[model samples]
Target chain A: MSEIACVECGAEIRLDEDVIQNEILPCPDCGVELEVMSLDPVQLALAPEVEEDWGE
Target chain B: MTRVAMVITRVRAEEKMLLEVFRQRGTDPELIRDEELVINPSVIDPRWDEFDIVLQRSLSTSRGLYLLELFDAWGVPTVNSLRTASICSDKFKTSLALAKAGVPQPEVRIAFTPQSALEAVTELGYPAVLKPMIGSWGRLLAKVSDADAAEAVLEHRQTLGNYPYHVHFVQSYVEKPRGRDIRAFVVAGETICAIYRSSSHWVTNTARGASVEQCPVTAELQDLCRRASEAVGGGVLAMDVFETEGGFVLNEINHTMEFRNSIEPTGVDIAGRIVDYALALAAQLERGEGE
Candidate 1:
């Protein structure tokens, strides 16, 4: 899946990988037809380790 | 009694024609100004359910949509039906339906907020058209040649009225149609007539001072209109077609269409067809048996 901003409403939409490359997707927010582009999926960044877990 | 309900504007030639046709066929049509009758929202709850077949021609006001939906749920038949009419009223919905059905339409996007409107112009680039989602007859359509001008127009529009809460349809501007665009009338998936609308202005809508002339209906144009109508579901439709840089693009589809003096040239008895079609459908439903 790739996240694309709605060209009409600017709402972020997660288009399916296949739909992004081939099909047009309507913005869930505004119902505008958008041409979905293929983009590299962003990997989630890891959170920093807490200094103290002993207290818990 | 063959109960026929006509939802239309106050009174016009088209409405008169429809009434005349119904009368000639011995059917009295009840004229209902669906928008004007809305004294209270709840008033619609009762009268809406009594109609057998609802037909609408001109509904310019935004409030007309409420009536469209009311008739939709009222469990009756309409000329174009509510779903098709509703989609045709909104350009954004029309484009989405067309694209999904694989009908050729210009690349388009809609904008709700001011921010997105700017971005849409940016992405679509210059030389595009910005139109209201639920507009008709070529009102409030602006063709922008550059991004700066497009942004200014959007900014001006935002401040001119209450900000629109949703995105309207925006699309790339098609090349001027050698001074003419095509309007094809389709009924039950069949092409009834096709006419070329010409105007000096870029907006070639008949409502916007365009002149209609008979155009030879090519096989390709017929197929395009048919595909566009079928893609968005069947209806008594008016499909606006134009050739764009990309190719033949379906500009828009009108469900509740108005065919006035323009039909005189086509030699198509539009009023007769509409009335006959309704009567035939009503009969086919097996609901009217000399009642």
Candidate 2:
């Protein structure tokens, strides 16, 4: 498991060791959107609200 | 009991949906990443035999074509086929095939130099579209309305210096019906569902804030789509069409199509259909019915 503090409430959230970058999750404590910023050290940050549109 | 090789460079929402549908049906495909793969040219990897068919969904155009070509050379069956991917990835190639197939498309001109491009723009008149020969999702496409705009756009592309960017693919910008366009999803030469991308912008792609609405699959559409698919060798394809005063015009064909927004609007289980198609192709190959 990997550990990262939630940006919203500072609540520590445990993630799977193999979590990939750009994987999205919600902070359980504060409900803030969390995004996997990097995988090397398992960084986390408040995720930008995504409109989510990709090209064809 | 058909095995599948799901070639995915990234797990986008569309890929995830396909995976979820496959898992539900108890036939989870092996996810293969090109990044993690090391290839020895002309040598088949033992790992390649585990799957019967390869369904490619790579994001990059260059990577998708190379992988398809490599897999074809190795004699592994692939969805969309090697011929389809190579031709559809290049706008100029697509135009030639569409023309040969007697399909109606907007006027297009290909130029290798900036001077020729400028001349092509003059013949095409103002407000022609200048697009990269190889691209998707409407990136780097410009509408050239005047000589200055044409010169500037062509100059910028030359400055970009990428080989693909220099091959100018210019098309006459047909006025879409009420600023809307249709994208029909075809599976195995059959038209599955059609969706109208409604937007005020000239490019009515779903990625450009276009709202989706279900379009009834008329017989004309069925015939047009099937012809478009067969033009580039039969396989799964997405047909983008436009409506002008002259009627429907085929815009482009996509090999690795995205359909995240189409599901809710069309109410068609696209992922499930794709999984079923992949499995069927695998079965055919196992029975020595495939190339």
Candidate 3:
């Protein structure tokens, strides 16, 4: 496991060992949804907003 | 070895669960990002042939439909075939299929212009719903309680919305007891499990912040789901049903369903079931039985 700063709250957030690319997780501090953009460097970005045509 | 392709836009919780289930089953399906894909219709790409079957899981309905159609044209089998996705992606098309199949659904009317749509909504009476021809997650749904509200919504659609939004699909609003509706997950023509999404808001989609609870799959629900699935050309589907004074009526049929919030409440491994269905389909196609 590794810790990353929450982009929204500037608080440290823990990530699981098995987190995969594009996986979505909520920041424990601010609760903003973040997406795992990459794994090698452990990049996190805010999840994309839902589009008009997005659904299932 | 059965090769499967799980197509997706972004790896949401549902996709993550599906990947985990596939790994647990010793079958590591290839993850195909829809955005990175480039298909040359003039030339056949051998990369696509590597997978026996493609699982259409893109969150974008248009992307999913286009991908499914392309895969079908290439003679590649896909879960929820192109025909199913085509119908499910459009609300009007879904209503027609359900009506033809004798499946119970809410009364709906299609209109081309905003004026006609307002008239249609008026005919359906107050508390009617105006939905986009193609959309999901209960987005852009207007519950018109009066003529003023209907007119306002129609004007907004005509002025600001896109081409699809102008083509109004109006339906009679069915009152749900306690603002709750049922979502039944159907896999391979079988109703595997169901959940009740309750919300104080009129739109009860889980994505809209609704709470979920397990809903028992009764014989009535099972039969309804079976007929609905068959109506849409059969595959993995999610049926939204509303309980009314008359009985249960299907609200919509979803082609690429999300089941992350359903596993715990329903006690069903929805992702596992989906993976199993896809793998079975891949094996069958590989054996030439699907042809």
TM-score of each: 0.75, 0.87, 0.97
Q: Model 2, DockQ value?
A: 0.22
Residues B1-291, candidate 2, lDDT per residue (tens digit)? 667777765666778778778778777678887657777886778788566788898766667778888888888889879899889988999999999999999999999998999999999898899998977778788998999999999999999758878999999988877678999999988989999998888877786789889998988889888898889887778899987776678999998898989999899998888878887887878888864
DockQ per model, Cα: 0.01, 0.22, 0.85
Whole-model lDDT per candidate? 0.69, 0.83, 0.90
Worst 10 residues of 3 chain B by lDDT: B282-291
Clashing pairs in 3: none
Runs with alpha carbons beyond 4 Å of true place in candidate 1: A1-56, B35-50, B165-168, B244-247, B287-291
Scored by Cα lDDT, where does model 2 land? 0.83
lDDT of 3 at B90: 93
Candidate 3 has what TM-score? 0.97
RMSD of each: 21.1, 4.2, 1.2
lDDT (C-alpha) at residue B230 in model 3 = 91
Candidate 1 docks at the CAPRI level of incorrect
lDDT of 1 by residue, B142-215 (tens): 89998788777787777774444245567887776578888888887777888889888899988777888877
A1-56 per-residue lDDT for model 1 (tens digits): 56756655678878554331212355678766554233354322211222111000
